[model samples]
Target: MKAVVFSRYGGPEVLEVRDVPEPKLGPESVLVDVRTVSVNPVDWQIAAGHLDSRFDVRFPVIPGWDVAGVVAEIGPTVTEFAVGDEVIGYVREDSIGRGTYAERVAAPLRTVARKPMNLGWEQAAAMPIAGLTAYQSLVRTLRVGPGDTVLIQAAAGGVGSFAVQIAVAMGARVIGSASDRNHDYLRQIGAEPVAYGPGLNECVRALTPQGVTAILDMYGGQTLTSSLDLLSDESKGRVVSLTNDGILEQGGTFVFARPSKADLDQLTRMAESGVLTPEISTVMDVTDAAEAFRLSQTGHVRGKIVLRVMGRLSAAIH
Candidate 1:
């Protein structure tokens, strides 16, 4: 199998293409011919060794979490899936051992979900991590509901786009923060967009004089701190973050995305029904994965950046 792997962590330069052994299938695993995979901030963060203390990944790791493909072979114990089933899901962190920047990956049964038949591979690949984070952030951690006011930071980002749409579909009044360039785009997606620049907190205050009912902070640093101050005293106002999990004592929930087959399955169904959609910025070949990782780390991506795996999978969604 051809893959992009690196023995060390540093920069995009460290990622290299190589011919590697195919992953050995487990009794409960399915061998997928990966047609598409997307890059996330976690990919670059893990690659740069920023998560070494937490994830504890060994050297020579292949970095990717979101995968979409056809099941080429099913394990003996697998019953829900069969050969030629189209699937998509967030691979468990433990399976980061083999990685997804390759032609094939053997994914555990619990982590995989049926892909939406109507959606293309690029969109399916982009949905897992980003979509799950958005779903869990609003529906699980924050409990967003009708008439609620939600302020989503980085509203034009990978997770942020999903958060905005899901909050709107739930009947919540959504306020999104992003740079001026994305303001119009955010508004088109059912969010009341706010310019995220100097005095961003003041801008948000001006938008909602009653104070926001909830906040989904996908960006850490000052963005998280700003959200902590913008919450109303009522318990209805809570802050949920995917990038930060520290210093929240003011009745706000701190959150991190955990992969779940049930959540992925629900999200895929939503995508197929057109209740939710994955926004894809660009799609590139796996051999150009370094470029995809570079684009993801910029923090300015309007949506997900996907990598189209080759050879083992068919030619699609390039």
Candidate 2:
């Protein structure tokens, strides 16, 4: 099978497309013939050795976690899906060598879900990590709901975009912070847009005089610190950060997205019902993974970046 691999820690330039052996399927996993894979910041961060102390890494690592494809084979103990089932998965294993950046991936049942029929390959691939992160942070952690005004930092980015939509669907009024360029995009997705940077708190307060009921911060450091005072007294503990663990010290929660088939199914249902949509910023061939990683590293993309693995013939057949 052909896949993108990086032998050493560095940047996107270290990535290369190469022929690798097929992934070994586990008893509770299924082999997916990958149609599309999406780039997440964690993928490149791992490749750059940023997560070395956190995850076990082997040489010649394949860096990807999001996959949308068809099941080509099922494990002996897997009964949830069969060969030909269309699926999307967040294929993060206990280790970091084999991944979803290839022509196929052996995905455990816990992380795989039936793809939303309404979504294309790219959109389906884009949903897993980003969508799950937002869903868990808002619905599970903050418990956002009607009458609550929620502020989402970096609302135009991948996780932020999904966060905005999910919070809106849950009946929370969403205030998303982004640049002026993404303000219109934020409003189109049901969020009241606020510009980021200095005075971000005031901008959010201007929309809701009493301060927001909840806050989801995708960026940490100054971004998270500045938004702390913008939460209502009753909602001060409702803040959640995806990138900062120091949030715990501030009486807030720090979330690391976990793979849950139930959560993915809920997201799939939302997409099928037209309540959730993935914003794809770019689509590149799998061979150009280096460039795709570079694009993701820029930290300016509006949404997910996807890589096409299967060609047109396979796509048409499915």
Alpha-carbon runs more than 4 Å astray in model 2: 311-318
Question: Measured by C-alpha RMSD in angstroms, how accurate is candidate 1?
Answer: 2.7
Q: After superposition, how far is residue 266 of candidate 1 from its true place, in Å?
A: 1.0
Clashes of each: 0, 0
**Residue-level lDDT tens digits of model 1 in 1-318:** 677788897998898877678889999999998899999988888888888777767667877878999999999999999999999978865534578887888898888999998899999999998898899989987878997899998999999999998899888999999989998889888999888867888888998887888888876787677666777778443788676666365455676678788999889778877878888899888878778888877789998998888662223223
Candidate 1 lDDT score relative to the true structure: 0.83
Each prediction's TM-score against the native? 0.94, 0.97
Per-residue lDDT of model 2, residues 1-318, tens digit only? 778889999988998777789889889999999999999999999999999998899989998999999999999998899899999999888889998888889999999999999999999999999999999999999898999999999999999999999999999999999999998999999999989898888888888989889989888998788788888888878999999899999999999899999999999999999999999999988878889888888899999999899863233224
Off by over 4 Å in 1: 248-251, 312-318
Best by lDDT: 2
The CA lDDT at 257 in model 2 is 92
lDDT of each: 0.83, 0.92
